[model samples]
Target chain A: MSESAAPGIDTAFPLSPEMRAAIIAHARREAPRECCGIIAGRDGAPVRVYPTTNIAEGNRFYEIDPKELADLEFRELPNENAEIVAIYHSHPASPAYPSRTDVELAFWPEAVYLICSLEDPDKPYIRGFTIRDGQIAEVTLPA
Target chain B: MASESTVQVLIPTPLRRFTDGESRVEVSGATVGDALDALEARFPGIDERVRDDSGQIRRFVNLFVNGQNVRDRDGIATPLSPGDELGIIPAMAGGSAA
Candidate 1:
């Protein structure tokens, strides 16, 4: 399928263990409140994980800082010839799934959405999905 | 009066569908609003995603000129310079389970 074949859903992209560990670590550090970040990739594969600030008013939601996003898009990513392959956020007390609010705010239809659930602090569960036009489809991750 | 200037608007990933998969587009305007108007004229249906019904920049969309946020400047009224870079970035946001 073409890159834009399905909009925001990469049907064949896989994640690395290091990257998964990074996300899990971030979720643990920001426990009780949501943590969020970006997975930068080059040539359809991940190269870096940017642990971004969650600027929302409360723990129930997450909004990345605009300045950090600007720098990543205009400078870092361009310099590295990388793009945002996925966007990951944590759910301190919920399941590893897209919430109703997540589906509603999933504006980047081309980005894989990764959700890390800290519901079981001892075993953080991570899952991936693609949300477009208020629809959600699960994507198997961590290959 | 300042002359209208040509600037490049960087289209983020999500809005690329409206921009024909283009990452950057050139437009002319004296201010950010004018540039946005030109962009919409060239690529229909994009204005609504970036701005609200009231013509205000959507709360979740960030408009930056030369890496400086318009919100920190003069909002839509932020002035543009020749060869300036404007970026339309959708805020990365979401929440937990239902």
Candidate 2:
């Protein structure tokens, strides 16, 4: 499945324990307000997590710092021989699913969107999806 | 009063198809609207994506000039310099289900 990636969603995306922990930690740290970040890595697998500032007002919206995203997209990611494998955001009060806004603003059809849900707080749920155009497909993200 | 001077427009990933995969394009215009008109002339269907039926910028779409929001300036009438950068950012509202 890795050799032949489909046009949109990858079949499987396994997250590392450390990265998962870090993502959850970040979500907890920014509780009540949503946190957003990106995972950069080689090939199709992510190597590191990049936490970015959510410049949008309120908890229901997130606009990544354009300069930071641009630098990573144009310079840093290229220098590391990597691309933004996944973009992650936390759902502070909702389920681990893409909202209407997420579906609408999914610019990268190729990258996986990892949404961490802190609805339960104690039992945080992290799910991954591929959002292409206006359609969404859930992918298996076993950690 | 649009001139032949070229202003760079930063096209986001989703709209690359209209640009033939070019993330950035140079178009001539005196104001934001003129540049967009030039872009629409070059790329047939992009105007509809950027604007609405009333020719107003879609609420979810944000156009930035020189790293500043056009809404904060003069909307489509925002003046442009020869080397100004215009960026298109579709608003990404976050996780909480509403």
Give the interface RMSD values of the models in order.
1.8, 4.3
iRMS, candidate 1, in Å: value is 1.8
Per-model TM-score versus the true fold: 0.94, 0.81
Candidate 1 local lDDT, residue A102: 93
Sequence-dependent TM-score of model 2 = 0.81
Model 2: CA > 4 A from native: A1-9, A56-58, A65-82, A104-107
Which candidate number would show the highest DockQ if scored against the true structure? 1
For model 1, the stretches where C-alpha displacement exceeds 4 angstroms are A1-9
Per-prediction DockQ, in order?
0.71, 0.32
Per residue, candidate 2 scores C-alpha lDDT tens digits across B1-98 of: 55555799988655677888787899999989999999999999998988998989987677888778888899999989899988876654455655
For candidate 2, give the docking quality class from DockQ. acceptable
Tens digit of lDDT per residue, candidate 2, span A42-89?
A: 766779899998887788877676656765665577678776677889
